[model samples]
Structures are given as structure tokens and as C-alpha cells.
Target: MRKNPVFQNEVLGAAILQVRSGRARSRTTLAKALGVSPSTVGMYVDRLIAENFLSESGVRQGPMGRPRRLLTTLAGAGWFAGVEFHALRVQAVGVDFSGRQTTAVVRPLPAEVTADSVIKTILLCVAKLTEAMQGPLLAVGLGVPGLVDPQAGIGLHYAFIPDWNQVPVSSLISTRLGVPVILQNNLRAIALAERWFGMGHDLNDYVILGPRSGFGIAMVLHGKLVEGAHHAAGEVGRWPWPLGGGDGTSQELHHVLSAPATWRRLAGVSVREKLPEDLRAALVEFAATDSAEWQAVCADFARVIGCLQLLTDTEVFILHGPLTALGERFCESIIRAARALAPALATAPLKVVPSVLGDDAGALGAASLAMEAWSPA
Candidate 1:
């Protein structure tokens, strides 16, 4: 069978509009942007409209003469599901055509969430959320907190969710739910969310780093997620550091910079205050420059950032998860230490920003995956 070049062009044109500003462009405008004839652009728009990928919203009155019909992508034509599996909980959200979330649910599990239990909980959540959907779901996106084989939809290793070795998450869920599914690393999902709608909307290169269940990193280069050959590109937690041995198999930094780890190292200190309050207190106490424990944690964070700088050469590094939840002060301390370790890089002003998406990144990324699947054809 032969492929339709016009249809393919239409899909590309629609995707460009969908991702750029979510606004519809006229045939003349599209032609000018795509360097094609107005007639060709009209044909593409007509096909996309016929496929229900786009619709004529109304007419725009130009200065020249008659009003021209404006076409918009139909965001409500279908829906997709996104899920994020974390150590303590599984967060799921449903997104419709316009990239608006329809439903969101979070299910907490034991510290050790078994494979069977995780699947069962996810199915239950899907059932609860999709009860009102008018038709079959389009696709599903799952984010796991470790290495993943995206092509096979399998989780190679989830350090936080032990016993998830080589689990074919996509096939298992697709079999039960009867829909296409995609599996990705949690950190990669975070980077995707940022790239699609968050701080990374304009930037072409950046990195997201922090301690979740364990430390993780995700990079966006040239406006695309840089998943390596085996889909384990940004696994920077294993990088060797001065505080840890060079074997590169230890979770030394995870244990030193994590929320619970930081609190444990502080002995009697409590992080019960709100994020802002906690940050203020930590900043004042650390400013005294006498807390050996605080200094050690900062050093560990700096080591991670230094390695990330040398590796990805990303200008913007976003910090989040339990560590940043402790407060802005903690994040500031890490940034300060990171600057000290790499003086030259700091002098050029490496932006170590906090995560803008927070806990919602996973669900949003999942939605984005679904959107990509259901995009115009």
C-alpha cells in the first residue's frame, strides 16, 4: 500500500501548530510558514478536518476583504491517560484534546509496592477516573523511577520499586485495558512535562535533577529529550564522587541528599514547618557555618551538579522532589555549593532553578505521551 504524503504533511503541520501555541492558522498563513502553496495548505487542512483532528472555529476578518475561516485542533476528540509510579504512591491524570486535565487520582502504597499490587491499584484508578468517558480511551503513558525499555514498554530496573526488574509494564497494562501504552523513566517524564508546558517551553537545552526515591537526572537537548541507545541516558546517580567510592554502584548521594537522609543526618532537627518556613530556618542555621552535617549534604549535592555540568553541559538545572520540598533555602544551599565546586561554570551563571511543575509533572508528561499517540494522522 502507498502512503499519503499530503496526509503526512497535514499531521506535521497540525503538530507544529499544536505544540507551538495551540492556535489555528489560516491556509495562507500556514502556506507562508511551511513554504508551500496556499492550495496545498488548504488541502492539508481539509484532510485534517475530515479526520476530526481539526475544526473550523470561526472566521477571521482580514483587512483585505471577505472573512477567512480559522481552523483549530480538536482537543476533545479523544483522551489519554498518564501515570507516574513513585516509591510511596502512584499518581495518575486524564488529559483531553486541549491538554486540559479531566481527572486526577493519587493512590498511596506501602514502602514496598509489589508488582501485582501496583498493577491492581493502577487498574482501579483507571476504572474510577474513566467512568464518565463517552468512548474508549486513546492511549496510556506510565513513568517509572528507574531505567526503562521504552520500545518494549518494560521497566528494566526501578530502584525505588524493588522487584520491578524487567517487568513488561506496557504490555501488561495494555492487555488488561485494551489500549496502547508507553513506559518511560520518571525523570524523563519530568523533563518532557517541562519541555511541553513548563519552564522549558522556550529553552532548547536544560537538565532536571534531584533526589526522589533515589537521585535521578533528565536532559533536554535541542528541544528534544535525550534518551540514549538503551533508554537509560540520564542515570547520573551512579556517577562517582569524592564522598563516594569510584565503583559507581553505590547510592551514597541518594542517602546523603534525600529528604529522609538529610533529616537523619541532622539527628534531632525536624522539617515539619512549611516549605518556606523550613527553608528560612535551614538557611539561618547553615549560615552559622558550623554544622558539619549540613556541609556534608551540600557537598554531596554539589558533586552531583558538577558531574551533571561536565556531562550534559546544560545551562538550566531544575531541582525538586522531597529535598527541594524541604524549602527554598535547601535548594539555595545546593546551588551555592554547586557554584563553589565549579567556579568557572558558576562565574558564567549556571541557572539552578527549582522545579516549577512540582508533583504534577508525571501526570502531565503522561498526558503528553497520550497526546502524541492520538495526534493527527
Candidate 2:
């Protein structure tokens, strides 16, 4: 039978993505991971090598078999710009074809942020990266903070900024930059960062619990990101607190578990503009003390994790954002509370790991999006 060009392009793209993301390193592994025959993978690999999109690093000698050739992306192939912006700041990173970040630029948003200002800042940051890297920019991927229609390339709404509804952000940027632009929810983008380059790279199912200025989650089930019907699947922030409670006055998890809420409860501040040394010390002491308020906070976190795990059967819960500053003890407290809530959770293969990407996760995730969208064809 003959081959479809579109299908061949998809397979080729997947092969490149797997190699760039470290999911597969050889044509054999790539074929196994992609569910394609070795010959099919070889065909695409040869084409990619000819196109300068991939290269053979060396050979891996096994104990009792022919050495397997290692596959890797070529850095000079091209580059992509990834930008993640929120009410507070904008982060941009330049990633080569192999998914390695060449440089990152971060700029704080003014006290009053506008859509135009945000776009201008992003363009400026991309220009800086373009100048610094001196490589051809293939495309741009943007991680926007609120509801977004990724397929439509539109930002539906962002509560943080007024008049940030139904903005043609993707086209605006693409038109100005003269390249293709892809958009995704910021939290979901962070989840992509983990799935592509962080700890969740090897896992098929996991959750990224984001509790920074806001509370939300991004889930990966069966090696695919769950975008949901309305692109708001992990908007757990809007879930009512107290689990099954139906009290009309119950606060949303966003208000109860977010860093701002936690800080307000502990330090009488709603925002984390500058966590003073004394405040940081106090936070550490507070967690160590296990005071009533702190325990309540931990208990709330545990309930969220337990509920999500029960719903999704996720293997790991990667914690990201300001709450991570509380240290591993905080994670321990959540685990302990979850076990107390349900003894089964204690025996379950559940892991709560903190994110290693720090503030660059969203930016890196956006870059992954761009890399995934690019095709060698």
C-alpha cells in the first residue's frame, strides 16, 4: 500500500519529539514507543537525519546484543521561542531543536498590566532571545494564564487582567513575529514541562498541583494531556472546599488553598511580593510547629490530593509554585494527612514530588509545545 503524506509527517514528528524529549533514543526504541515497525521508524529516521533534524550521538553497548545507535536532535537545525505571562511577570526562553534551552529572559509586569503591555513585553523578550541566540526562530508557543481556546488560538478570558477576553493573542503575536504561534493554558503548559523534560517524563499518569498566586491542576493520563470539554479540566480551584460539604458559604479551593490565602492566614498578607527573612523563618517554624492553622492548611492540601488521586488514579502529584518553599516537610505532612484520611492511600503507589523547574516551568513547557508542533517535513 502507499503511504499518506500527512500520516508520515505525524510519525516523523512523533519520532523527533520522542528523541528530543528523551522518551526514545534509538530507532528500535522509537518504533516500540510509537507502535510502528522498525522499518517504518528507520525510514523516518533516515529522512530526519538527511534533513539535519536528528543525529547519531554514538552507540550504546549492551551486555549481549548488537550496539544500539543513540539518536539525538541537532542544535543548529533551528530554535523556538516560548513565552509564559501572568499578572505578575513574563518569562521567555529560547529552545533549540533538541529541546535544550539556550537562554531565558524574565521581566516583571508593571503594577497595572494590560493586554497590550503584556504583548509588548513578550515581543521584546522574544526579540532579546532572537538577538542573543542568533538562530532561525521556527515558531512561538505562548502559555496564557486563564481560559484559552488553543485550537482557535484565542485567549478566552483571564480574571487577572481586565479586558483580557476573547483576545486574538496568537494571531497578534504570530503576525508581529512572522511565524506560527500556539497557545495553551499556563498550568497545562507546566504539566507539559514535567511530561517532556522533568520527573514525569517516564510516567504515563501524573498531576501537576499548582498553588502559586492561584490554585489549579494539570493532569496527564495515558501519555496525553487532558484538556477537557471546555479546556478547563483541571480548574479544581473552583471546586468547593470541605470536600463533600454543601454549605452555601463554603469557599472555593482557590480561596482556601492558594499561596495568597495561605499567606494571609499565616502572615496576615494576601500576596507574596517579598517573603521577608523573618516571614520565611516564620513559615518554616509554622510548618514545624504543626499549629492548628498550619495543620488545617496541610489537611486541606491532603484532601485535594486524595480526592484527585481517587478520581484520576494518578501515579504522582508534582507540586509547583510558592508553597514548595515550605520544604519537603510540608509534602510529608500532606502525605501523612492523606494516609490518615484514607488508609488505602498510604499503601497506594502514590508519590508527591516537588517540581525542579522552579519559575521556568511554564516557559520551558511553552517551548515544548512549539517543538511538538514543528515537523521535519
Candidate 3:
């Protein structure tokens, strides 16, 4: 006997997304967009409707005589929870099968949030959101600020949080919530969100440079994430920098790119202010100047990105975190520096942009992973 899978999961995923995106509402439109036979589309559509993943919402009266039936995803079929494991706070968001977010809440952890307390906080966040779900909460997606061993169901090393080394995180959550849990590095999680719904969606090769707590990088080459051996591909902090290197000085890439450090280096500027306007103004001042500190920061940025141009050859560079406070002008400077560093290949395909989804990126990425687990065939 021989068995071959129908291989309809990709089709099912595409159909669900097309309906949810309002791009292909009718079976005819879906088949045309997906470039599949009408019968193939009908088979999946009928199966999805029968399984309650889709519904005949109504009919759309087009310019022609006949009214076409419109289809929409059944948002109540299943739900997902996304949790971001921050050093000071844990945020949770609930998203439905139709990719609509239902709720989000952030719980502030106490000073020195420990591994045990982190689990408790996650449970609390999940409990708070699960109470409102109409359908089964299928899975929980977590984004921790550390390395995660997904196979071992453990968080390998939490950066800012204490005593999180080698903690059995997923097992703890699964025992409580009774659902599958997946964990990823926080920045890596955000990169996944960008790939699906943010700036990196259109390009096959791109890099996410989030120079925040630490200068981190995540790449998508040939439309797949470059998670290297030990799943530590984007750990750029360990790489040597600046054609002329440093001894943990201001010239070093990681030190110069640190968000709070750069912010503090701006003399007489403080993010702690009476209004957000004040902080934004300070950020603008940092970008609008040619001060020695600002130039040094840009130089360090150029060195790292220049090396990156040779390493990844990606087209887009996405800037987020504290540096984005300065806006697109700052990003432009970094792009120019990269071009100058590689004069021979001066015409590289490069576009520097900021993150669109902002604060919800981590949780949304986790939710996407959860949806992947429950996707229909």
C-alpha cells in the first residue's frame, strides 16, 4: 500500500488569507488568484465551509446581472494567544483564525523578574485573555528576550531576566494551559512578523536591524530565515567590526549601537520628560546634527552594515527600536555609509525603512506560528 498526502495545506492557507484580506471573495476570484483549476478551488472551498473555517457571508452585486457569492473566514473556528517576554513586562494578545486581534494586555513584572515569576506572569496573562475566547484557544506563542531550544522546550539564556538559563518554559506553560507552546528570540519573532505582514513581505532578501537593548540582526535569504547552527544566526554582537577594530570602546559596533547608550550620549537630553514631544525633539536634534558623538555612531553603523553587505547581500534594511526615534533621515545616512563602504558594488539594491507594526510585532508573530500549527489541509 502507498499513501501520498493531498498537499492542500498551502492551498488552504492561501484561500484563508485571500478571503481574510478581501482580495479574493468568490471561488472564481480565488481560483484565478491562486492559478488553480476551478474544481480545485471549489473542493477546498466546500471543505473549508463544511469545517466552519469559512462561510458564505453574502452576495456581492457586481456591474453584471448575476450576484456573486462572497466568502469570509469563520473567525470563531479557533483562537491563538501571543505573549512577549520582556524584561520588565509581559504582554499577551489574542488573535482569531481570520487574523483579527481580539485583546491585548501587558502585565508589569516586579524588579528582577525571575524565571519562576515569569511563568506565573505568563499564566496570568493567558488566563486573563482565555476567559473571553468563544472557541478553543489552540496554542500559545511566546517571544522571549533570549535564545530558545524549541526541541527541548526550554529557554536557553534570557538576556536581561535573572535565573532563566535553561528553564523548561514551554513545559511549564503547557502543563497549565493544556496547549502547545512555541518560543523564539524576541527580535527573531519580530522578524517573522515582518516577513508575513511588515516591511520584508515583498522582498526575498532583507535584514532587520533592531539596535535597541542590543544591536541585533535577523535575515531572510531566498525567502527563508537564516537560523544557523545552534539557532544563533542573527547574533551580530559577537562579530568583529570596524575595518579598524576596538577594545570594548566607543568605536565598537555593539557599544555604539546600544539604544539607551546612544540616547544618553546626547548631552542634556533625556527620554524621561514631561511630554513625548520633548523626547522626539531630542531624537530629531540627534539626527539633525553633525556632532562628534552622532558621527561616531553613524560610523560604527556603517562599519557593521558594510560587513553585512558582503555577508548577506540582502536588499532591504529595516530599522526599529530606539534609533527610529530619529526617523528616516538617520536611516538614509546608514544606507549611504554602506554604499560608500562598498564602492565597487555601489549600486546595490538597498532600501532602509522603519517597522510599521510597532509594539505588537512580537505577539503577532507568535500568533502566526500558532495559526501555522492549526492550519487546515
Maximum-TM-score candidate: 2
Per-model C-alpha lDDT, please?
0.71, 0.85, 0.76
Candidate 3 ranges beyond 4 A from true positions: 1-41, 57-69, 241-252, 268-285
lDDT of 1 by residue, 1-377 (tens): 11676657555645445533443366666667666677766776777778776777688899997787776657666777889877677898887655667788889877668887788888877787697543458788888777888888888887666687898898889999988888788788888787666887778899888576567688888878889997878766555444557675554556555555565565445545333324324534444343788777877777777767777778688876655544566667777888888866576555677776767788788767666655443
Write model 3 residue lDDT over 218-248, tens digit each, in one string. 8888877676789777878655554455665
- The ten-residue window of minimal lDDT in model 1 covers 273-282
Give the backbone clash total of model 2.
0
Per-model TM-score, in order, reads 0.82, 0.91, 0.83
Candidate 1 global TM-score:
0.82
Candidate 2 regions off by >4 Å? 1-3, 244-247, 268-287, 343-346
Per-residue lDDT of candidate 2, residues 159-238 (tens digit): 89997999999999999999889999998889888876788778889899999777889999998989999988899988
lDDT of model number 2: 0.85
Q: List the pairs of residues colliding in candidate 3.
A: none
